[model samples]
Structures are given as C-alpha cells and as structure tokens.
Target: MFRLVGSSVQLDIQDPKPEFHDLFWVINRENNVVQYDNKRKNMMYYSDYGGRVEFNEETYSLTLKNLQKTDSGLYEVRASGDEVRVVAEYRLSVLDPEEAPVLTHQLSRDTCNITLTCRGHDLSINSSCYKETCEEKEVTSPGGVILSLSVSGSTIICNHSNPVSWKTDVLEMKELERLCADEGEGEDKVN
Candidate 1:
C-alpha cells in the first residue's frame, strides 16, 4: 500500500515470480475493470468514465493527477493475474506550499570558498544542488544541500530539489564580500 500525499498518486508493484506478461490492473469501485492498451501499453479510459488514463508498464505504476473529491475511492490492482491483488484507498487532501526556504551564505576568505545553504521546513530527506555552469551534486545533511561555488563571478545559481519540488536561490558574490568585510572590520575594531 502506498500513500499519495500530492495531487497525483503513484502506485508501484513488483512481481518476482514472472508468471504474467502484464503485471498490474486497475479497477474502479463500480466493479468495472480498467482496460489496458497493449499497443499503447497504458490504461484506456472512455468518455463515460473520463477520457483515456495511462499507466506505465515498466514501472508498474499509475499516476492520477488533478484529482477531485469524486476521484477518491477504492482502487484495486492485480499483479500477475490472480497472484497478488493490491487494494489501495485514496484520500486526497490539498495543502498550500510551505514557507519559502531561507538562503544563507558562508564565505572563507583564506580558502576562497563560498557556500550557499538553503534551509527549509523539511530537511530530513536528502537534497540536491545544481549550478548553471557546473555539474550538479547531492549532499546529505540536516541543513540541506550546500552549494560550493568559486567566488569569482557576480552571481551564482543554486537549485535544491526534494521529493516535492525544486527551489532555486541566486547568491551574489558582492554580498559575500560585504559580509566578510563586515566581520573583518568587527575583528579589527576589537584588536
């Protein structure tokens, strides 16, 4: 059983026995079995039931998006014919996007390193970082992904992706310089 929390629900099934060529089936609550198109390799939906709905055979998953309350019901999936029947109940609850992520910068003058950190409400899962000119990197940390860019350009773009969506933050080198200069000035005053 899979819990789909988003607007679309995905169902994946695995068949190790390899008894059936087609691995899954979707049935509505009215006892009508959803038809699958072997040529298109997707589930076919009629205008009576609603236009054509599709599913991926390779992944053994079906995605139903823009779901309405009427879409909520019991969906049955049969794998390998009668081998296994997976019943799933869907309850759709919409939620607003949480707070925007807070982007922070860390600069090391001695090392010429600039790291941009994006902190969000949820960070338990891994996050990824991408640069416009550079390759993307993934980091596993409690504070999310830290994008390390050379402090030479005026602007650096960093993208963070979680399970839900991707968020981008643009950092300017001038801001890092100002922050480093401010810290240095504070230290000099103490000395």
Candidate 2:
C-alpha cells in the first residue's frame, strides 16, 4: 500500500464537487497543478518517477502512478471563490525499502574468530568476533542499520531500518560451524 516508494498512490475525496466555482487542486503549497499533472494542457512533464499523474475530472481525485521520494507531500482541495474553504486534505508518504546487509565472511581459526563485512545503501560495516556468540560479537552500526541479538543465543540477526521501512537478515551460527570446523575440531564450536 502506502509503504512502498515506487508504488502508485491515490488521493481521493468523495463528493469533492470540483464542478463548483473557484474549486481546484492544490499541490504542496501552490495553486498550480502543472507540476504534478502533466496532461493538463497536452504534452508531458517530469512524471515524477517515470510515471504519470492523473486527475479524474469526474471524481475529483488525484493519482500518481510509479511514485517516488519527491512525491511525498501535502495535497488539498479548496474553493477560493467567495469564501475560501479547504474542503479536503491529504498527505502522501513514499518510503523506500531498507537495504539488506550481506554477512560476507566467516573465517575459522583459533579462538573461533570470524570476520564479516556488510555493504548496502551506500554503507559498509566491518565486524569481528570470537566463538560466534552474540555476547562476544563486535559489530559497527552503519547508517540506518541495527545489529541485535542475545548473549544466550547463537543466532545473529542484523536489521536495517528507518522510521517507515525496514529489512532484516539472520545468520545461524550452527550452519557456519561446519565451515570453521576443519581445524580445531572441537574448539568452542557454535552448538
């Protein structure tokens, strides 16, 4: 629904009565609709996110297809003839999905040491740990990303999030144990 950034969005007001005199669509903070609606007078405009903006003349509704980050803003329907009155108000929010971080490497050696590097959304985090335990793990927090787990568990979960959207990835230490088990066969393996 409204949780996606490149998704289509609709702002509709039932019984908008746009046929009324001095009634028009107001975008952001302006009376001009050309910036939003490209088909007003024919030809084309920016289309926001390589899409189209449609204004239903019959229903008095505004629809922006293939929305983008710039489309997040306020919209209003008002009548400015005799007495100025704002009939309907709507707010559109477009949010991008949280980028997933990759747990790249787990090197097995003495002390059960491991090294991991995660890169996503113009951010990179490098972390190292011993025994692969949550308590012993050392991770660096990157932009809009969080790494959390419990000391008593062998599962390491890394989460990338924002106020509106988030994504998570889990690494099971049990599966990784086989990779680091060649040498030091029983040295504090992830059990």
Candidate 3:
C-alpha cells in the first residue's frame, strides 16, 4: 500500500545520479499520463486529470500530492536515454487510518486474560490471551492485518494494524493485579 490521503508519495528512480533527459513521462495504472518534463524545468502535460502532480527532473522522481483512493494503482516512468526505457515501476495504494482496537481484561481473583479487538470501518476481529503470553492472533483481513504479541518489562503488548496504520493496547500484569479489586472492566487505548 501507499501513503494516506493528503500525503505525498515520491517514487524515485534506482540510479543515484540520474541524467536529465529532454523527454520523460510518468504514467499511472489507467494509462493516464501523470507528468511530463520535456527538457524544461518542472512542467507536466495535464491532459486527462492532472489532480496534483509534481515532477522532479533532478532526481527523476515523481511525487503525487493530496493522494486519494483513485490514485491507487501501478505507476510507470519512461525516460529516454539511449532509447526509450521504463526506469521505474510502482504499485501504490492509499487508505485512511483504521479505527483503534479495544482491549479489555477479565481478571478472576488470580487470573488475567486480555481481549484484543480491531474495529475498523469495514473490518472487525477478536483475539484473547489465557496465560502470561498471548496466542498467535488470527485476523479476518489476511492481506492487511498484523497481530503481534510482545512481552515488555512487566507488561504484554497486543498490537493490531493494517497496511496504512496501527494501534496497540497494553496489559500490565502488576497493574492489573492492583486494579482487579474494583471488579470492573478497564481499557487502554494507544494512538
């Protein structure tokens, strides 16, 4: 996936030092020409939908600003040196920040079990822990979901994320032991 909306993404050419050729064009997935700098300094051929395009001749990198879902797709940059060649290729994707997951603890006298949940706009998943460590998380969105369990000095961190963003909830064993007296639910959200 690519950067989020309103962010800029730069697809750079592999070469450290690039030659400033007279004819260069960057095309998007739909065959829509995004940019063109013909021997001039920072000029683009805005034919179809220009949106927000920036072409850097010095580095031969194309930066698309104020990104949107429509901008997600394959991108190809063709430059003319000895002959016309596609120097760079990219598949970009953009999505909004997912909603933060919820973590609740079920403390029964002497046991601590943490529940982790992800509530995104279009996705929801649940996982739980029964011991000092958590089990391998199983999520619905296989391509975009990442669930990890890490043990800190005195806490266990349950992190949930997608391609564009992530959120975490911590379960401190010592802290829970202290707060369990209340016999109520507790939640910790990470931004």
Task: Mark the 10 consecutive residues where model 1 has the least summed lDDT.
Answer: 125-134
Instruction: Spell out the clash pairs found in candidate 1.
Output: none
Instruction: Tell how far residue 113 is off in model 3, in angstroms.
Output: 6.3
lDDT for model 2, on a 0 to 1 scale?
A: 0.58
> Could you tell me every candidate's TM-score relative to the true structure?
0.37, 0.58, 0.66
Give candidate 2 misplaced runs (Cα > 4 Å). Answer: 1-5, 14-20, 34-51, 57-59, 93-100, 125-132, 135-170, 186-191
Q: Report the error of model 1 at residue 86, Å.
A: 16
lDDT of 2 by residue, 4-121 (tens): 6767877776453633444555668674442222234332233333446776655666677777776777777665555766677777667787777565656745656676655555
Candidate 3: clashing pairs of residues: none
Q: Tens digits of per-residue lDDT for model 1 on 81-146? A: 436455333433333334445556555554334455555455422222222232224344442332
Candidate 1, residue 77: CA error in Å?
10
RMSD of 2: 6.6
Query: For candidate 2, what is the TM-score?
Result: 0.58
